[model samples]
Target: MSQLVIQDLHVSIGDKPVVKSVSLTIKQGEVHAVMGPNGTGKSTLAKAIAGHPDYTITQGDVLLDGRSLLAMEPDERARAGLFLAFQYPSEIPGVSIANFIRAALQARLGESAELDATGYYKKLYEKMDLLKIDRKFTSRSVNDGFSGGEKKRCEILQLAMLDPKFALMDETDSGLDIDALRVVADGVNKLRTGQLGILLITHYQRLLNYIVPDFVHVMHEGHIVRSGDKSLALELEAKGYAWLKKELVHA
Candidate 1:
């Protein structure tokens, strides 16, 4: 099974240090949720691992099945089975969802290998049906004038179609309403059948209610200060980050 291993990771945006000394090993079939207050570097960690050009990895390494991800470009990382679901899905006007995803799937195939169209659409429709999305959505421009829920659902659609070994989901529930949150969560849960490892980054515990995490990690400032099971998220919901801060002070 493929796994993502992060070791002593340190990230910087320009001269400002963000993620500091964070490490995690996510094996397939596991869901690890990273929780923290704003500015604690949860998003930075995800972006850095995804090879976002803005963030620099000053120290440490992120590995996929023992290969360093830092050596690969963003597209290379995607093709290597590492996927990032952005907090904000970009608007690609005039590009139909079908064409965009088909292009991505095609790129994964080498120059010599051509994607079969009939097979691609068949798989795409099957995924859309599984997510209970209307088949007509395939013709719409990607996230162009889409509602907040629609944008998030689109991200989930891409996730479903790509079927990456490891997914770094950065604040997926950020702008979602309760109903949309459930729908997106249900789609993700359906895909979690021991073939993928997910790192779900969010600020609220509500997202955890539907997509229960196997491990819960709390980030303070720049490093992970605490980690536990699902109950830890409930605890965070009950006692906020300030409470964790107080505990850290006493520790």
Candidate 2:
């Protein structure tokens, strides 16, 4: 089974520490949700694992499929089967969605193999149809002039076509209304097969309502202060973080 292991992770920007001693393990077919207030390093942890240069990993290791990923460059890590869905999807001004994804798949094939255009578009349109994305989206620039919901849907579309072993979705429900959230969540749910494990990071419990997680962890001050099954998310939703903080302080 594919696995992503995060062990004693400590991250920082310059000298200011953010993620402190956070540890977790996600296996294929499991969905783990990481919840916390802002500035608690949720995004930092995701970026560091995905090899973003800005967030320095002062300590700890992130392993994928039992191999250390710390030494690999970001693109190398991606080609090795890790996918990170950014909180803020960037706009590729001139690249169409079809060409962008095709390039990514071609990279995975290395220099010796030729890309099959017919097979590629067949799969692309299949994924778009599954995700309820319009076929015309293929010709549009990646995330250019898309609404917040459209951007999130585009992210899922990429995820579907790439079919990574593990997906780190950061705040996927951000800026999405109820309808868009359901659509994005439905697309994600369809993608959750035994070959795919997910680490979903979000601040609000409402997102959890659509994409139910196998496990829920509450992050506080850069550490996961609480963890449990899906019911834990319901508790967090009912009581809120303020109650959790008070309980932790008194405990």
Candidate 3:
């Protein structure tokens, strides 16, 4: 089983400690939600796990299965089946969506093998169709001049094509309308399987309503303060963060 284990993780950006001893475990077929208020270092935690250079891991370890991911480079981490769908996907001016995804898939293949272009396109088209993406979108530049919903959908499309063991999705519902959010949630629900684990990071409970998580963790001041089933999300939504703050203070 593919599993991601983060143990007592401490991350910093320069001298500022952003993630303070945050630990969580996600196994295949489980959907884990990390919800918190802004500036709580939620995004920092995701970037640290993805091996982003700006954030430094000062202590603790991140493991994929039994292997230590801390020792691996960013590219190596990706090739090892870890994927991060960014909250704000970058725009690739010159690269077509098809070419970019193809390059990523090719990188996974060793030098001895080459991807069959015909088969690759067929598969890409199939996934695109499943996501309700237009056939013409394959030739468009990645996230260039696309709407907010389109960018989020593109992220989901990449996840479907790459088929990673673990996915770190940060604020996927950001900037999306109700209809768009539903579409994205449908894609995510369809992609969930026994071989895939997802870490969904978001600040809102609306997304959780659509893509009901198996575990919901409330992060306060960089650590998980509470964890429960999907009901926790609804409670947070109704009561707001102030109630959580009060509970933490009283605890």
Candidates in order have lDDT scores of 0.95, 0.93, 0.93
Q: Over all chains combined, what TM-score does candidate 2 have? A: 0.98
- Please provide TM-scores, in order, for all candidate models, with all chains considered together: 0.99, 0.98, 0.98
Per residue, candidate 3 scores C-alpha lDDT tens digits across 1-251 of 77999999999999999889988999999999999999898899999999999999999999999899998899899999899999999999989999999999999997889998999999999998888889998799999999999999999999999999999999999999999999999999989867889999999999999999999999988888999999999999999999999999999
Residues 158-229, model 2: lDDT tens digits: 999998988999999999999999999999999987679999999999999889999999898889999999
Higher-lDDT candidate among 1 and 3? 1
- Candidate 1 lDDT over 103-142, as tens digits, reads 9999999799999999999999999999999999989999
Kindly report which residue stretches of model 1 are placed more than 4 angstroms away from their true locations once superposed: none
Better of 2 and 3 by lDDT: 3
Worst 10 residues of 3 by lDDT: 187-196
Model 3 ranges with Cα > 4 A deviation: none
Clashes by residue pair, model 1:
none
Indicate which candidate wins on lDDT.
1
RMSD of each: 0.6, 0.8, 0.8
